[model samples]
Target: MLKGKHEIMLKTSLGDITLVLDADSAPKTVTNFIELAKSGYYDGLTFHRVIPDFMIKGGDPNGNGTGGESIFGVSFEDEINADSYGLHKLKLGDATDEALPEELAEMTQKEYLEKQGYIFNDDLKSLPMEKGYIAMANSGPNTNGSQFFIIQRKAGTPWLEGKHTVFGKVTEGMDVVDAIANTEKGANDMPVEAVTFDVEVK
Candidate 1:
């Protein structure tokens, strides 16, 4: 372990998530999220876009895709989710296999991680949203806003290898995360039942 890092436990309505904060790899990115998440900006928000077998997208405060920080506060100069870093992220077609059943996803993510070999258990302590990784929303490069997503199932979005800025991954409570993704959507792809969200970190 190079340095000591703190842990954050995000307790969502769907379930709970225990994540290790990465202060090195994506310092600015992490700082932005930690600040916003702790400030209660993401609380009570719904997963506006929930694709059952693909990914769940949300974080826009307005419940609309266009919702988020009006002013560009941070540059998505990401350390990961770039078009490089040599990652083989799942794509649309890859997610066809029953969507990895969110219940076992947290434990089964090892297989996906092993295939990429980017999963290092050392104490490098940095944001690595490799495979089954989580990332912020970006209309384009370095255009991340309040939106984010978790690759619940594998897909064929190889081009997405370095396109999205990945900041974290779902280590636990992936099943619940899946539940949120599986929720019925309305006309604008908004959750039918309004699957509310709340995060807690310990």
Candidate 2:
């Protein structure tokens, strides 16, 4: 288990980027990332997907945006914050509004929240998906593996809200991310010149 805040250093061919994982909000995901980094799982992987003004994606062993496994070799669920969506605004008669025991027993926490009219707001929507935000890349809900991406634009990506998992943010060196994102690419969005990564976790 992760004890406290953790920082990951990614030394890429373009340059170095540092990330501060959100352990408090996404502990399991943070721990998984740390373990993968320490084991050198991301040492030589290439950022396969690069769309200028969008984001730069990597962490796929195949370097084709199709292959990677979590440390447990299985998929994991998302860890989104609930208060970000005004769920805390709900109140009942003379009491703090909360899901009843019957509701909790019948459906998952996310389902219960949705039933209460709380749409999953990505990073609260208030916390814009600005430049340098790092999020997990998944096939669908709860499919986060080793693959992840870094937002390359200063504008907020509200479209991606509630869809992908934002597990961390770039603490420094977004210039390297921008450089990689601006690189020339061929078919399949693959960079013409390889951009590999080596991570140091602390």
Candidate 3:
């Protein structure tokens, strides 16, 4: 797996939050983030979307969750390694063809997986979308840009595993994260008072 060491400090309006990036799982995504952080691209950006028990999202140039781009000035493909999360194995056996849905009965394992729209890589190790994890926020497949979100739900959001590229996790200041999440929000889950921050790569 591709790996590198990267830690960043987010000096937010509320407090500081520290994150350690996992380049082994998402090298390109981490690289993009570090580039943006170093260039001050994320300075003074607001966490545009914040759900109390879900996540806090930001890094959008528009500060509305609809705008942002990578250092390359475009969206990039998702980095999802199914093996690390055990999402590569097919749950149903070939012997169960008779009981399977008509459309799936004749398909091979790979075909079935492709039909389900799961793209993965054997070279990388994708981390799960758990509490405190940081991930790219995209509209859909391969649409990743500069926007990102931090998981807040204590049990985690497993449903997002294959959908988003998880690049890092909170290493300190989770209470600051908690406070940011619990802040009063209005339209589009935006904090009534904007929650902006400056980030530093370490």
> Which candidate number would show the highest lDDT if scored against the true structure?
3
**Which candidate gets the maximum TM-score versus the true structure?**
3
Tens digit per residue, CA lDDT, model 1, 17-60: 66665555555566677767778888888778887766777777
> Candidate 2 on 10-55: residue-level lDDT in tens?
9999889998887766676788889999999999899999999999
Question: How do all models score by TM-score?
Answer: 0.68, 0.78, 0.87
Against the reference, the lDDT scores of all candidates come to: 0.60, 0.76, 0.84
Q: Model 1 misses residue 65 by how many Å?
A: 1.3
Query: What would the TM-score be for candidate 3 when compared with the true structure?
Result: 0.87
At residue 3, give the lDDT of candidate 1: 23
Q: Quote the RMSD, in angstroms, for model 2.
A: 7.7
For model 3, how does the per-residue alpha-carbon lDDT over 1-202 read when each residue is reduced to its tens digit? 3368688999999999999998988998998898888899999999988987899999999999889999766888788875666544544355364587766665545445446665667788788889999999998878889999999999899767667889999999999888999999999899999999999988
The ten-residue window of minimal lDDT in model 1 covers: 117-126
Model 1 backbone overlap count = 11
Q: Which stretches of candidate 3 lie over 4 Å from their true place?
A: 90-118
Q: After superposition, how far is residue 146 of candidate 2 from its true place, in Å?
A: 0.4
